[model samples]
Target: MAAASIMPPHTNPPPPATARDPTATVSDPQRHRDAPTPSLRALFLRAVDPSRPSSWSTAVADLLSSGDPVAALAAFAAALRANPAALRPALPPALRAAAAATSLSAGRQLHLLALRSGLFPSDAYSASALLHMYYHCSRPLDARRAFDEIPAPNPVIVTAMASGCVRNNLVYTALSIFRSMVASDSAGVVDEAAALVALSASARVPDRGITGGIHALVSKIGLDGHTGLANTMLDAYAKGGGHDLGAARKLFDMMERDVVSWNTMIALYAQNGLSTEALGLYSKMLIVGGGVRCNAVTLSAVLLACAHAGAIQAGKRIHNQVVRMGLEDNVYVGTSVVDMYSKCGKVEMAWKAFQKIKGKNILSWSAMIAGYGMHGYGQEALHVFTDMRKSGLKPNYITFISVLAACSHAGLLNEGRYWYNTMKTEFGIEPGVEHYGCMVDLLGHAGCLDEAYDLIKEMKAKPDAALWGALLSACRIYKNVELAKISAERLFELDATNSGYYVLLSNIYAEAGRWKDVERTRVLVKTRGIEKPPGYSSVELKGKIHLFYVGDKSHPQYKEIYAYLEKLLERIQEAGYVPNTGSVLHDLDVEERESMLRIHSEKLAVAFALMNSVQGSVIHVIKNLRVCTDCHAAIKIITKLTGREIIVRDIKRFHHFKDGLCSCGDYW
Candidate 1:
């Protein structure tokens, strides 16, 4: 298309040539030879076109500054027709307009004009602008070709080229270009922008060796002392290149930090599962980052940490801050608050937060549905899912997993089967491994063992350890030793290192009185050095976390906690709570197994929470493993005796115990 058709000429006369940033033009080497400071009309009137008036270049700049890029292109064509020399000062703005509009067609025409006018090789500003234009338009190949056409690139041109490659996810290529920038002669010396690009590349590929090299170069060039480059490297570390939390913490401790710096470190700690440390860093930001008030990003990251750690008190405080800052409507922070409350075992609070989100994105809807599902409210989750679809947001694969899981817990087998069968046909989502696992769990929970096994056999994707492990757990509950053995074989083959599977199979064998099989499995586990993660329960009370292991006495208040637990057991037994010693799978006599059942980790955590917190307050306990059947029953009775609501989150799902019953209907 012609330039006039692309951007028709405007009837209004354009303003002066010096309308945009003075630097937004191709640098002219000889233009300074004119007047020391030219008048407004002659500002860009270089001697290259003494015959042409400066107004030709003036029109292009005016249209560009006024945000009329289409009109700018038309004026650019007129300027070129008047004098080709005008391109030296007028080309950069036209390229800027192209980049801003993300128009590759207009940019390509300008690229041709720049090449034909002999400005590409000499003008650094024009070359950089062209590179940025191609980058913004998402044409990486054109950017690389434009970059290659330059003979001797300056630092600006090299930085621009590296940045474009990094933006396009050609990280290794960006690294190569950065290396050349460092190795080339004086004109291509590494600058702050080039260093940041190289650091970003190192992070994407997650090559610690490359990051180390760049880190050394940054230090040698004294860029490490600057906040901009330092924060970039911190971000690289956070993304898991060498993931050296120690080095990252050290760098974080020494650097002159900004809000971005604090946010990166917090995200790094949280991502590495050091959520406690992440929360600590956020606290430090409040105290040490004197001028750096918390922003939506900071609150979002810290709220996620709170969710993972069950730091509800800290989460509530952050929510209050979000309200104070009038960021209650921020999609990110609002969604984070919902997730925090949901995972921390406060679904009612999550619903409140979910309702307050003004622009509820897909993530917000998914979080709310998952929250309802975890609380054993299958009907509520389905209703919210329907509302999500009505709100014009299509459910993704993750949403289906939550739906099926809710069905599994609430015994909605028909609904679960309908969603599983139609996920591909209705939502166009082929069931992935996670979806398959959720379906297996759902079918197995409903005692449809034959059908669950058949589904596993018919799966298009390979069955993972989680899928087989689900079947093994179901077999233990349903007393199907035959299928359990087959599931065990597949589970061990896929993930031999998972100690949980070995324990699950052993428990199945033991519960069946197949002592020989149990002994054999235990011997195999011992020989392979497989150790199950010790079960521990944690309760977040008043911003401080309390941990309890089986018969734990490590706390300073162990005396009071143990004493309280004994009184609770007596009271619960008087109220018809029987200690279900059947869960103790070890080869012990009935008395020893009964004694062992009295002090399970979750019971101790509940006792501690009961003693420390105010009367009638709800207690939340987070477990690192599945809650045993004995503790599940006892907690339901404890909720009744203490007149409190106890929420327990195990590895598989959340169990809400209130009024002498569990939300799972004693099924899970």
Candidate 2:
């Protein structure tokens, strides 16, 4: 059983007859096949001869070039043991290779070798290579250890360490490193690249003081002309949660415009509810025509603006443009398109766009569900959710919010409660305030006020003003004066300056025949300097937005609009429509109440839409506030009389009036 007899020579294979001959005392094939392979250390020693200095370098190079840093480091260790002098020159290259390959263990070993050989602190290149290796491996502490060992770190090393800290969510640490670099002249001067990294870190921390300081430093260093840095600063101001839009715009205007600059400004405006200004700036960007083509980002931002502004025609044009640019398949742009169409009262178009999306993500599905929910298509929303689950996509918290909201709007109480429990039990998503708010709204709408109150009491999180306001609105609808008063008291404490709450409380008093209380609430409103914001309705026709305020007579066609509205009112009244004078909430006579209801913004906007747009066309109107009871009733009658479908989107949700009925079935 000699070892050389059992094993064949390097150049020869074992004989086939020996494999088949059990009588010849053949070695077990399975045992031979299961034998342990040579270790990297053994392989390295076999490749190099200690007496040959050239052999050490050649063996290290071959191992390093094997595309496996682990094996390469073992060869490097053996070479170092054989001849440290010969391997010293190759250690830096080995470290660099390990860094490129993202070999953390190999890099650590090489790092130790450099430190032991006294080549670390004195050799900036080797130290930088080790720092880079640790950064790529996402080991910030190791990167810092290597960085601190550098006796005189240069700008490149400082930037690398700071970036590593930022990438690892150590923004404060990165900023400290950057400040230290600035304080010490060891790195001579911090360049724009380092400043960019510092600005990025500052943005993540969103420290206003740090961001302003970085801005000053960037200007003082004359790096303000750098477009990329300026763009990053602009994003910091706009999206850093502070929302310093004025500063963001100023910075944006000062920069020489690029596609990114336009996109950032458009997104900032859209996010801050300045839809008109956002669309205006988008138009300006197109008009300036500096060869700045609209990309997916631009289209998404502008589409969102159109959605907010209820510019259906404008949104449709953008949709056509998206198709032309072949960006309809992009998840973000497709999601925005669906949102715009849905918010603009085009749920059918939203569904079509959702289907066109190549690979639908969570946002895409959620947008469609939200669209259907907003339009009071609750059953359709539930169907989409079922399809989403079947497609193997797990719904997130936002998706459940939309589903629960759909249920609330459609009076699907049982479904709403079932999903509310399922969110916690099945998906393990603890309900947030928004989810609880929707549940409260659902119960309140269904006349289960006591149950809603009990649920609120059981809430883990404190209810916000909006949640209280939902309960108060329900009280108003159901004429529960006592609960309305209680809800209003809580709402007042949370938001005393909101005039709508005071007006709502006054209306509740009037509904309950509490005249003195109504007067007292009105006096409180005046004393608090809470002026009710005027409600306006806007309809986009022929790509131009026409706005109508309460009793608005400023438009050049106001006379015609009023005349047309008077005639339309006569027709709706003849169809057995009685004005809901109770909604006036004033001490005026019956005649005055009817007159006030006639000139409501939604009524005026509807009249204008009838006179301007073609017959049988779906009229889309957006109101700044909720639609009043009188206007809501009147629109239903008008739609039946004129044989036109009217879709009105208010602050709350969509109302579709067709053939004397609304999608909400008179519940909303």
**RMSD, model 1, all Cα superposed?**
7.8
How displaced is residue 223 in candidate 2, in Å?
A: 1.9
Question: CA lDDT of 77 in candidate 1?
Answer: 58
Model 2, residue 194: distance off in Å is 3.9
Of the candidates shown, which would achieve the greatest TM-score relative to the real structure? 1
Model 1 ranges with Cα > 4 A deviation:
1-147, 168-170, 185-188, 205-213, 570-599
Q: Summing lDDT over every window of 10 consecutive residues in candidate 2, give the lowest-scoring window.
A: 1-10
lDDT of 2 by residue, 132-244 (tens): 77887788888877777777787787787888788888888889988987787643367888888887887787556676788898887677888888888877776664667
Pairs that collide, model 1 = none
Tell me the deviation in Å of residue 333 in model 1.
1.3
Please give the CA lDDT of all the candidate structures: 0.79, 0.79
Model 2 scores a TM of 0.75
